[model samples]
Target: MLFVTIDRKSSVSLTQQIYDQIRKSILNRDLEEGERLASSRGLSAAIGVSRNVVLEAYERLIAEGYLEVRSKSGTFVAKGSFLPAKGKTSEYEKVMPNVADRKPIIDFRGSHPAMDQFPRKKWGQLTRDICYEAPDHIFGYAEPGGIRELRVTLAKYLQRVRSVHCHPEQIMITTGATQALRLITEMLIKARTGISVEDPVTDEMRNIFFSAGAGIIPVPVDENGIIPECLPKEEGTGFVFVIPSHQFPMGGILSIQRRVQLIQYARELNNYIVEDDYDSEFTYEGAPVPSIQGLDPERVIYVGTFSKILSPALRMGFVVLPTHLIETFRRLKWFHDRHTSSIDQLVLSRFIEEGYLDRHIRKMRRIYRKRREVLETAVRASFKNAKIIGRAAGMHLVVDIPDIDFDDALAGEIEKQGVRIYPVEHFAMNKGRHTHQVVMGYGSLTPEQILQGVTQLKKFLSTRG
Candidate 1:
């Protein structure tokens, strides 16, 4: 007879509880192979439960090969069901450090948009409308490049907003900019050739290329983005990856002179220029700069995403490939995941066609601009010597506090004081140059949170000083 106990108050069903205990006993070898189990009726009475519960449990166990039923005989433990228990502590658990349970009161990490402001109601309505009225073929596997409607809409929108020159047929939709980068890496990076990227770039960007078994030639960056003059003169370079619209961490706009130089260098090397037009939608100051791809579409591969504009949860982005790379990219994208969500692509197409995307960008620009102002004001007031770097664009600004090395230890200490800040040094490939600076993002924080978080940061720094 098997002894089983059931807690009537547990959220788990009685059937599951009975099934779990019997399975555990069999795996632990408490019930040896060929050992007979009590009849469903007898076990039901013994455990004071309905006979149906036991029968269901037994059926599940038998179906899973844990218990077998012989003709005219009772249920018996399966011959090969025994599995010895391993030690509780795993090898991974033994080596890895424990993560802290407490979350920072205010996190200043960049690249996150205001998720709370996501137009959920409108999005939901659009989704519902798309599902109801969209043709049945949309539910099936779509073109590996993307749906025709979305690519067409994006071609016009990119041309209008960012001055990108592209045909709808050349556009390939990706899960996000990350996927676009991965696919591009696969297509471009050869065994001998490597990529030339901005030094002090986002760590994620560096990791993507590095993980792809491609070498990275670190080109130094300044307040005006990648120094084109310092670009490697070698012939073994595959492509130059740059966030021209707004550089990460340092937050610089690549100057036109530098942009032209970058294009010429790529042409000289006979390589492509991977231009990541990240967060170009919200510029607080002068007119938005035109994309480098517009200057030389043949040599420049343009990558754009809706993650920063709307919500990262959407996982929607696109890449404009040069004419020659389109077919190869399509094959690569097909093998990667066949395609991104078709209904999502349709919904986004409608969103752009209906002009909701433009309106949302305008609204978020105002909100984010106000938050940026609040952050700048608070930081200036709190720390008189703090110098804000970068162009007056994007969601983040770099704060240069002289005489302070914003390394991991100091950042960790500040986190303990209920605030979190990212050190620019952490993003650097060459290190030590940006030890005095930190990147503070106001995209996800409200004006109130920005003000309070900066105040707390200043207070913590004062105590440390």
Candidate 2:
């Protein structure tokens, strides 16, 4: 005999309720295989449901193989109906590792924009306006290369601001620079070909290449960016990856002389150059440097993103490929994700066309410059032996503190003090060389937070002495 209950007040139909109960019981093995079940007429009376409701429930269970009818006899639990049970979900969760709640800290880990300062009102209005004004086709699947309006606007914007020479047809929009790098790596990395990258490159970029099964040839970087002469002269090199405008962690701008040498080297080797012009617009000392792509657009793949200038949440970035690689990239992009969000692309196009992007960058440049100044001042005042490395550009600066090895142990101790700082060695492909340096980011921090973070760092370091 099976004991079943029915709820008269439930929105679920009586027939469905009965069907679900029996199915669940069989699956749970509470109603064992080959066990005889009561007749529909008897169950209706026992559960206070109509006989027809019970009949329908049993019929569904029979059709689903949970119950079977034996000619003259009543329904019985089907053979092979028993499923081995996994342990309770709660039991499994009890053994899962627990991640502690993140505490508020003065985070100096850079590459983040001031998200609070995002022009939400203007962006919201643009999104609404674009949705209403755009054609119905705007919501459909976009071209793999991206919508035409955005590519055109970005082409003009890049040409004017960064001196990148490219036609709109060559631009490919991606989820972010990260994706752009991934796709490019996938398309370029052949068997026995390796990527030549800066030594102390961002760990994220290094990992992207590593994930693609491409070998990494680390060219040592200094205060003047990647040493052109140090780059591998072999022919198996696929391309040279660089952050010339503002080298990450080290913060060096590649000189025009080295830029030309890099282009000549690529030309000689028949390989290409991948220029990542991230956060180059926030220069505090002088005008932004012209992109190396402009020097030899045919040999350089220029990648840029709005994450550093706008917000990472946008996940908007583009890559300018050589004319020869455009078709292949489009095919790769089409199969990758079928293209980025079409409506977002359209809204971003209008934002750039109407000069909102330029205005926003200009506003952010001033804010980041002031924050960088605060960080520089605080570090100088707090650490008497600290020497700032790199140019006075980008959101983060590297400070060389002699005799201090900012290893994992020291970094963890600093974090315990309610502050977070990134060690330069953390980003190094060749370790131990940058142990005395730390990268300090102030883009997302206020003046007070920067000062307090520096003070905390000073106190923590003094205790170790």
Candidate 3:
């Protein structure tokens, strides 16, 4: 006999609950096609409900095609029924469209990681271990600054790899780098200040500061990153958001001299700098650049993310705040979101402490290097006229296609050829300047896909001309 429990306290009536459960079973194939259900009297006795209630529930299920009543036989599931697979929707869909149906043949879009390479098996094992071993308190609401163990582990990891100067007390776990930036934009960088941003910067980063009520001051970037000499000398500049390890869209590292120059300018102006070290772990050109935070820990708020190293769906990122900003940042996070998931933080703590995070990053570094090399070689072979920049370190590099307009129309036409690529100017606030450049991100693509995407790109460029 199938078991069915009734919630007497629920607002839902017993008849409706019975109907719902039966219908759900039919659709889920738990009651397969032609599987007979219990008779009304039997169901009523089993559920301790009136026979009339069971009759009504069966009648409803039968009327909906979830159950079919035979002439002499009792109820049975219909031959065909509807069931939504997984029935899940992403929070990102609220901001973007439902593009699942029309996935691009080869996506060259930026800011993605090699998701296929993620160690989901090891992560699953670690998660299960934490679920059984962690204290009961870890399942409840936690400190807005994140679980202490994760923060401690992150502090040690950042210091070892990025050369960031930070104590565990100053680290706050966030959903990702965006949340970290959003907090800094709203709290430390109020609307009254000028936000010095890189020209041809990503739209998402630009929007964060703009939404926080700050005016953007565009600083020009070259192969070496934001020109420190170009930084505004005017007062009221509160913060500078930079991806110095490997810039976005442009993909360049800030030189040591420029790092010093920018730090000195911030010191003189009494401002803050938010260093988004989002992809420093994938650096292939020798040792990665030491973080600017190491240069001036008191002035730089170092932010990093597992989205690139682990999985984007994990939504785990952290910021190492300056001593003066730690309290204020934590308070702001409390008001915004009490905290990130405590269980996730706990599991991540164990993952890092057990050396999985380090091992995984090391493995990915090699994989990403191979992907980058494949992309670089394919692009060079296919587009001889184009120039590649910012290949020193990062998941992506810029391909400058001179003497042509890489505008929206060109992009649309390229898409019509079944190749999805974005012009670098598409991400820039100062758009016209980078019109000839396009960003090719290889992190999320396989070597075959990388070659295929560039081949399609070459076809369109050659034929279009």
lDDT of candidates 1 onward, in order: 0.92, 0.91, 0.85
User: Where is model 1 more than 4 Å wrong at Cα?
Assistant: 1-17, 24-36, 46-53, 68-73, 76-83, 92-100
The lDDT leader among the candidates is 1
Sort all candidates by lDDT, best to worst.
Answer: 1, 2, 3
Kindly indicate the candidate among 2 and 3 with the higher TM-score.
2
Better of 2 and 3 by lDDT: 2
Per-residue lDDT tens digits for candidate 2, residues 1-465, read 477899899999999899888888898899999999999999999888789999999999999899999998879999998787975678668777556856678999777889889989999999999888999998888898899999999999999999999999999999999999998998888745699999898899998999988999989988778899999877898899999999997999999999999999999999899999999999999899999999999999999998998889988999999999999899988898889899889889988999998999899888998999889888999888999999988899999999798877888989989899999888887888999999989888998999999999999899887
Report the error of model 3 at residue 207, Å.
1.7
RMSD for each model, in Å, please? 2.6, 4.3, 8.3
How do the candidates rank by TM-score, highest first?
Answer: 1, 2, 3
Tens digit per residue, CA lDDT, model 1, 116-193: 999999999999999999999999989999999999999999999999999999899999999999999989986455
- Return the TM-score for each candidate structure: 0.92, 0.83, 0.81
Q: Model 2: runs farther than 4 Å from truth?
A: 1-101
